[model samples]
Target: MPVLAGAEPFSHTASTEVGVLLCHGFTGSPASMRPWGRYLADLGHTVRCPRLPGHGTTWQECNRTRWTNWYDCVHTEFETLARSCESVFVFGLSMGGTLSLRLAQQLGDAVAGLALVNPSVLTLRKDARLLPVLGRVLPSVKGVGGDIAKPGVIEPAYARTPVRAAASLSRLWKLVREDLYKVTQPMLLMHSVVDHVVEPVNSRVIAEGVRSTQLTEVLLYDSYHVATLDNDAPLIFERSAEFVRSVRQVAA
Candidate 1:
């Protein structure tokens, strides 16, 4: 499948021993994370942003993939970074955040730290409970993309929500929530105070559930769900870089 413009995965090889893996949200392509990756790379940190399977293409194709496919893609990228760097920090937005948390849980100290933006584990939508059944009859619904508060900034995401893929994501959410206690690494969590796609309670759930002793939470007042590309993006980038440096220094 031909990937969309600006949606291609990106990687930067730096001389530094520290690396950062960036994961974009469900249905969102690497375009959403490209700037952040560039910022880290400019700071001489090895960086990667992989395009999850079923993304960066048609939503119909996305419907054919499962959450495991996305997770596996991220896992491969992390392994690639781990092979070349002494320490690897995982950063994610939305569902990418969920996958990052799972990595920290399953990989343990292999993940030096985590920086999450609007990571989602739960949703309050009453209809979400019926996704398992609805997916059988429905192929898709309205998209949840382009929720950025910054005017004129657009996220390269699917125009429709793939029901089957979304159903698979819900299952992944349950698993991540169950294993939150295993995520013991230091974490930097940032969320939009006025996000329309993911509720603030989602971040609260993670903050309360994670076993990390060092947890920093910042609320984005100017951005929406996709804060990485919104008005508060620079703040997210700066804070994440600082967080990675602090964690890597401690690890050293």
Candidate 2:
């Protein structure tokens, strides 16, 4: 019998010279980041968006992996991008943004900047505690986004959430919040005021917590949770490109 290579091993991205490492949301694949990745790629950025462990596969596979595996996968991709490109930027969505935050904490001085779309950190509503403990158990959410109309990116392939895997995500956020002060890299945060999945407060909290002197925020006026493929996706790409350029100028 042969051993399976796992999720990250299955994720193969085309190599590029100057690129971005894009992390997708929880229970999401590279598809979630494809729009932004392609947008950057069109602007001459090499883009790398790899699927995390137990992702882009069956939900059972996802349930078997933890947050550590997911983090390691993204970190590996980041290293690959850095080695291949003259300069590298990091971008992420939802849970992916959480991973980006952790990366910034570790490599603030090295990271050119960050692009976070609809970032998810603390998502439970303020009144969520009213529900009973059992009633509050995280539900297994499947693919819920509407149509995705982008220039180059396609719809994500996987969506079923692994309840256990989601716990790992929460655990990772717990660790990342404590180190928020360590991230000083320039950041561009984009989110919708009407996002149904991740509350806007998540992005607000991150913007307030990061110690970076260079930080910018964009509110998606006509989108929901997945702003990358929503009405404002083009703006996402444009703003991200602009932010990266500004960061480069600052460094220069």
lDDT of each: 0.95, 0.74
lDDT of 2 by residue, 1-252 (tens): 222233232222454535688888776667666657667766777777777877766767777788899889888888877877767888898888999999889876667788899877775754333323322365454544333433453445446556667666777877888888898888898888787778778887898888889889898887777777778988988898888888877777
Using all chains and alpha carbons, the TM-scores for the candidates as numbered come to: 0.99, 0.83
Candidate 2 residue runs with Cα over 4 Å from true position: 1-17, 125-159
Roughly what TM-score does model 2 have, to 2 decimal places?
A: 0.83
Reference-based TM-score, model 1: 0.99
RMSD of each: 0.7, 4.5
Candidate 1 colliding pairs: none
Backbone atom clashes (below 3 Å) for every candidate = 0, 0
